[model samples]
Target chain A: MTPNLLVFRVLRNPKVTISLSLADWDLLLRQARCSNLLARIHSLLNEQGLIDRVPPKPREHLQWTHVIAERQIKAVHWEVTMIRKALAKVGPIILLKGAAYVMAKLPPAQGRLFSDIDIMVPKDNLNEVEAALMLHGWGTTHHDTYDQRYYRRWMHELPPMRHIKRSSVIDVHHAILPETAAIHPSPDKLRSSACSLDGYDDLKILAPADMVLHSAAHLFNESELDNGLRDLVDIDSLLRHFSNLPSFWVVLVERAKDLELTRALFYSLRYTTLILHTTIPPSTMVAIEIGRPNQLTLTIMDKLFTRALMPDHPSCSDWLTNTAKRVLYVRGNWLRMPPLLLARHLFHKAFISPKPE
Target chain B: MNISTLTLSELGHRLKKAGMFLQTGTFITHLKTSIPSVAEGIRLLYADYPLVEHLDFADFHVSLTYPRNLRRWLKPQIQFLFDGKPPFKPLPADQAFPMLEWGLNWCVSSHANHYLIIHAAVIEKGGYAAVLPAPPGSGKSTLCAALVNRGWRLLSDELALIHIGDGRIVPLPRPISLKNQSIDIIQSYEPDAVISRKISDTMKGTVAHMKPPANSIIRANETAHAGWVIFPKYQSSVPAQLKKLSRSRAFIRIADNAFNYSLLGIKGFETLTGLVDASQCYDFTYSSLENAIETFSALEPPASSK
Candidate 1:
């Protein structure tokens, strides 16, 4: 059993014996902390009636984290209400990712922690939506011209707007993937398939399969690995919970192919099953495996992702992990743009301000 | 066995390798560091803390280490890692001990939500605890150091961990951090106090920590109910005076000084209200530590304590 597997196994079956040494528990907690899934782990333990079995001291800490997550979820609901009121005049706004999971009361929302709210609107309505949000005290974060132009011209989302009063950030996206990316998911199709949330007339949640595909796209296409493992866990929970529905897997595969996200779905299923032991139907696996990377690429991806998916903690990491993350970071940029554009972006990013001061 | 049982060298060896699990009050922290000042800080300050056995679980696993790069030779710095993640950038190596103290406070304030933690100083006398909730540079730690030396048991110098359900103050009797001029003021007030060496030119401007009373460390597990909720302010050359503060005002002041009040939401509100209900509220201003200590000692004890 690899080190990363321990946290997943214990989370999967919370009734497993609590026999780890203090040092081992420290490592597990560190890994969970890095992934931002400590509260989720605790909630799972509580669900399985194993929270009490955890030693008294560590239990107190986990309980504290659980309380914080509860408050955060309440804050998310309040933010959603505020957004709903602001965007009431606009057409239906579809919630995406963590916000959608929470609004829809999915299993992944249980003790989930998130920092931003993502919503999708029609591309033609983007101007009206941005203006409405601005009037309602949400303004775009102050970015220089280059950043503003970059986001406006190429990205699927507007420069993220933050609330002046509440300070919660909202990402207003017209589609799932960036327009400049090789694959463009149809926003109109996604909006048409979105289901209206109960009691929230203006708010809609993505169809279940779209939610999973979007999560996968966001995780696999992004350069940042700080939340890589947590996002994968989100994918795992989404799959496990939705798999309970009849023909969910069948629809999920069909939807992936229709949406041009088969590549992302292929990686998501591979890693979720490999790392989390997520139960994917064998037939569904065979259907999706058509988009799997070639053997040489698969071997390289396995090396990079296996290390990258673990929380960047000392107890679960070694020398190769950082190297793997850096290699993947460059790869993410390469995948996002053509070679000439990618080179210019990298140079501009490197010599200019590396980070927002 | 507690950390005091280990020799300085043994403690250093353990810190360099796996870690030394030090149990304080309600949490166990597995701390690893090879820096000499950090080792010395643990030897001098945490000597009385209980050492958790190998099988027990720790609430936080932290490390203080030097950055591995050419920058280490240029300026030299230390970093605080919680579960191998750096929350803040590295500070100069000389600030390591103080950084450890700050890091421990960060761990509790940022993560410990089971309690309604306020940025306050708490000290106990008889059977009641006086919670001094104040913002930085308020001289709360100076008063706390003075009171504890004069027989008030130090509950905590930085955080008043109020139990959410019961509204009792959980004792986390760590060292009293005195910043800037308060470092010299504390030394002059308690000439015999066991204060660590002052680290000059910190972000807070020359900070030093006074050793908690040995009795407080020995009785770390003992918690006390809130009896007086005092907001202390220190002004130069002014005489010490304590005045009765309105309950509503006290509530607002505590909520303002709380680290996780908003994060805990309504539970934080109820806990603060319960605390104010159970204790007499006061606004205290003092320039003289002697006068301040005498006033706190003369306060009427809570009805339950009597």
Candidate 2:
């Protein structure tokens, strides 16, 4: 294997420890991100002191590659705290992706790397909770109140917002799919089948079956290359984590049927498997996809999605432009919402999109 | 074939050797399998973790089951957990993380529970805890990891437990994460800090863990009164800044950020309301970790007398 490929191979092994010089790992990170994302990463490394500190115990203190993992653990811890605090207060929050995996208490960064937390809440509590957040230090960054109202009214989720104190942006979503999806379920029905985390008083989230479908929907619904391997990672982790329960697959298919999200799920499975080289069982994979997806559609989406994940992906702009036109065409059919309503929803997202500052 | 994309059972078979079962709330995680080989992927990933004993469960079978698909990535983990096993090939750290993460999720979420779990980052200092709840790129984790290194106690880099009865912050102190460049910044700050092995190509950028401070671990279950309700953001080259937030906005933010806020309905509302009311709210922004440390440490915690 090439040197880079060697690193990839070493990473592929769960047991192999190819420890690099701690400083070497730090240098590689600089090359790993775009200027914008890299700046933020460097600050975090400086703060966590990963650049300065070598591994302490275990006699492998010099390996900075392993030390690089401190960032992953930090992210998991941050995501988990959000889930726990919510669970502690109102009820158990339905955790998704990285947060859920991390809270289960594995090595902090060993789970998935999620970009933003996607959480669902009881629909009735949406506004009440939004109000509650406004009162705390998290403020609405967007100024248009109508846009905010549009989100609460039409979309399943609110626009993201920035924290007044912390400036952290957050997406307070009430639903998973937007009203625009060509094939989708009503928010009300999705909420009905949602599962409640038992540790809480009355908190709940989209059911596991629904969650998987939603994951698929998120992957297939949009222009497809916004977030990188994350959405796929979510699907991969969700399927594996829930696979032990024989009923999970069966329920997933059924839920997809009910929600009309099967097509997306099918495409997602077909493409993720082909491109990322995901290893779903042939039986389960077939069941998940029914007949195989069109090779062309799968390839296009897969290539686009793959590019989105790579920070230094060479053709990002061209890919994104092409993806945008396709995305709009898809959006036109999926969403039957009026232009006015769509306008309102978009407005809500701009203002309500979660922000920490 | 890349083992990461494999299914959970496949991984179980490949890495099956030794393990244990960990159950909490609606989650059930089996660790330390009899085969011992399965533990290889995760053992090294979590090698530094302090094991705890629970006398409550003797009835269930204890076996290790990771997201079977993740066995290949978890090879290093096996060596971390198994001391006497023959030397095995270890995968890159990040590749193994997903399988370990998948296994942990099954363990925690599968266990029966009474709390509505969420995904977030929590940190406490001087009896005042700040909960940073966000999705990727919100800079919540980056800031939380930084805070813990500087004097603020790491309640948890990921999950925080709020007492259902009184809305107090419960500690689940664990490692802080730094991704890509952030990993180096943290090491330079405290070279002696215990960080986990690095794993690249995760959902987030290259990921790493900052061993949570010892004090946070010793007081893992300690409760701290909600002091200032401040959310943090790390914008490069941005000077440190803080500002007040409105009540209505705070309500929305907290409710949105909360995992189970609405699950508790009136109770959740009351608890959240009380938290915001008792704590002075602010939105803080900074680019420098040093400034962040100085900024937080300089803040006067909510008056204890109040």
Candidate 3:
């Protein structure tokens, strides 16, 4: 672990904050804000009943972020409702990521803050869903011809849609990962196993095992490390909550193998345990070893993931953090597409396109 | 210690390296810059504000630095960085001071959710504050600057932070920002008032800042009750008319002008409504700053307010 990463130390043991001095809080709050985890820290402290122990000024920051996160959750609930209404006749609307956490009342939803709502529909119903949403004030945000073509042809999701009046955004997905990617998790399989949300008949969430696997896949495949720590925390919370269910680990391992997501699952388990001290059953650990990279790759990945997954704050970063981040960005793109297509996309973005406004 | 205690070279040296913690009303900004105008602006306008020691935490860590590109050499631009990220586009180097002011306001409005932040200027007299909520070109700042010079304590000239728990207006007095003719008007209005060098041709036309009164800075901890909610408009050749506005109308208007009213949800609605219920609401239009000051001077504290 990197030395003096107060945020990591607190995340590993929220109780340690009870012993920190005001100066330590000065750094901790700044690091948490930079990492986009201030509300998460606030929720952690509140869960343990340690908020009052924090000094007044630092507590205000935590409290302020709590206000924002609370507002965001309320907004998400309204947005999800409007989306369900928009797609009522289309098909089942399976909420993903942040929206899913809130709808399912998962542990990570306590203070999660996210900008967009993600939902997955059947591939056959994509056109109907798009038309329905457009009729309800949501408009496609992208305008460039090539960019639009790339999303329509290759990406898992359509170009992100935003409401004309409210400016709220939604990402409509037909699958979990890009069609061009190495892993080909079947959208039908995920849809068939989704569980209906409590009050709504049309609203559904990914089954527990698939939820963990999808979070793992999404986090490990991302190039942008700005929210790397926050996403990892989600995986950790999901694992801890779902492990209580009967046969969850066994089902999770089987699902990962079946879905070709074992590599992402392996990395998720390894880092969650290493960084957040998450506990995994001994047998489950042995079962996931099949997905582990070779010794050399494991060593290199440990160096990169450990650094890249820390808060993107100067206090949590070292000299090689930038290099590790850059390498991971390239690796993320490489993992998402064929070499030729990836090259074409990068070239056009760099030279031919005007930068996004 | 205050900024006036530091010589220009010492102030510039600190700003160039470790930065200084400048206390303005309820928040302290750890400010850094190599731009002489930013440093000079602080030395001139913020001379009376307290300088917090290094051991305490600052609410915002901000800096104005030149962008590292050919643009830095071609036309010369300055960027405002909150923490390590730039929240705004680079402006002309000469507008560096105003950029810092705007950046600091952004920091407060965007992050300070502990209070119900309104896009209004607030001034207090005899423990009663009048909240001036208006859009740009409404002559809000001009009237605020004139009122402060005439005896009202400047709570803030941009954001009015109403405490959520108790409806008290938290004082956040800083340098009063003046634009275009108001700059010249203020200079001739009070010849002894310290105003910064004006920078021209920027987004808000020409801009300058008048030093806040030292008395207001010394009384930074004082909080005031809301006495009035006045929306001011600068209409040419108009009489100084102060007309009563319905409380419901004032409530909606104040919420509309707030930076995070909707974000605060029910709590924002409650706080704003409570402020309206406690204060007299009015729509004031005036062509002359002198007449505006005379009208504001006659406001009385609400009977129910503490």
Candidate 4:
């Protein structure tokens, strides 16, 4: 088994704590660091009362990582407060992804490291929202003309803006998926159904089912896999936490079908179960299996994802893993843009742009 | 058994395959490299350090090897990997030993947040640890090497890992790095000191490492109470002087020099505040190693002696 898988198994069943030697903890810590889930793993171990079993040195490392995550959460809250005051007149702002999970205090936000704050406004309000953020210290990041035009004309999000003083990035999205993608998710439906966060009339979070669907869409559609395993763990945590509510599974399946995200959901469920061993009712699994790809396509996807979901560490990787990631990168682009535009985009990116030194 | 017991060839052979695990005070590192200079550097500097057993776990599993690209044939470069992930870009092949030392520092400063780590040099006299926090090119290492040679126990040369709970400095007695003119200065001051071969044109200019004293390495695991927070500034032709610094100002400067102070948030703030509260703080300036060493020596109480 891969070291990452071994870590997950231990995290899943904390009671099975036979003495893990320092070498075993070393491997687990390396895998955790690579996957960006060190804090999450620590939290799980702490929750199961198994932290004492870990050796002192690794325990100190884990506690240190947890402290960092806690600091990041504090930063997120501070940024959100500034955002709220900045966009007070722009109407309700919908928090998405990591920021949303944290603001709403979901299970996935426990010890979760955040990169940037993601928030969505109505499509028509994008310009006003951007202007308001700019008026309050957020400025568009400098990008080449081609990237600027691509984001403006085809992408669902604006060019990422960073706080001039604090240097934290905030992504302003009007939709979950890019406009040029094959499937169209209705932004109006999402905006209308967003639930209001407690004590904040202007801030809203995605509904329970929509949050799961967005997480699935994000994992299956993104090109980068550096944190692919961590995202999958997020999905698993979200599923297990939300599944405690009655009818959460049924509503989740129906929402996937309604939002035309069955394929993403299918992949999410398949990998989360196969890799993380997240429990889903047998009926729910059978229901979602309707969107599963054909045998050959499923085989190729399994090959790609099984390798892709492992931590991006050399010890956890082999020759096929990199090749699979490259293949899936092209597939992501193909899924996002049409054949002709994708060709031009790839050409410009490969030849026209200056390579990073 | 300590690393000194292993033959040079045995050390090289083990490094090429399963790696040689060597223990510093706070962390044990599994280091692997085929470069002869790197192995020699470890032997020269870390001869007195303990060898971690085969069954034990190392805090960091690092490797330094030639990159597997056409650059390896054309210009020859070496990369430093921590647990098989490269943190920094490749450097010239000759810089392998320095790169290993720098990479180990990166590992501790970045990952070991259990302690409030400052980018400082630390030495202890009569149980009073002096923490010299300074920026690069500030002659911190020169002063540290001079002190360690003249009867001070070397706690650490680059990093000062302060335990958050007890407010004590953990000893991490690695090699003391001296750069440019300071290399000549240190060598002249202590003729018997074993200095490594100089590698020029590094980002820090010409750099060499001084083997830590045998006594310091023998007491590697000993922790010292935080006593003095001295910010040393080396000015050319300036007379040796030490100005008293207020606790609040010392707190801010030390926090600014810390590697992961803000990353640890409240615990970091509390630890730094506690350290500043416990120590007598100062801003020291000197051009001569001998004068600087004398000034630091006088700061200790005469009642307590080794």
**What value of lDDT does candidate 4 attain over all alpha carbons?**
0.88
Cα lDDT of model 1 by residue, B1-306, tens digit: 667888899889988998887777777788999998888888888877776656446787789999887889899999999877789999999999999999999998988888999999999988789999998888899999999999999899999999999988999989889898888888887799888998999999999888888889889889998899999999988888888899998999899999899988889999999999999999899988889988987988878555
TM-score of each: 0.95, 0.42, 0.98, 0.97
lDDT of 4 by residue, B53-83 (tens): 5846778889998989999888999999988
Per-residue lDDT tens digits for candidate 1, residues A30-132, read 6677778889988898888778887666677678779878988898899998888888889789999888888888988887888899999998999999999
Instruction: Report the error of model 3 at residue A114, Å.
Output: 1.0
Docking tier of model 1: it is medium
The TM-score obtained for chain B by all candidates, in the order given, is 0.96, 0.72, 0.97, 0.96
- Supply DockQ values for each candidate: 0.69, 0.02, 0.78, 0.74
True contacts kept of each: 0.91, 0.00, 0.69, 0.88
**Model 2 - which docking category?**
incorrect
Cα misplacement distance, residue B192 of candidate 3 (Å)? 1.0
- Please tell me how candidate 4 rates in CAPRI terms: medium
Clash pairs for candidate 3: none
Alpha-carbon runs more than 4 Å astray in model 3: A1-4, B304-306
lDDT minimum window of 10 residues, candidate 4 chain A: A1-10
- Residue B110 miss distance in model 4 (angstroms): 0.5
- For B203-238, candidate 2 gives per-residue lDDT tens digits of 566777665666565566577877776667678798
For candidate 2, the per-residue lDDT at B74 reads 44
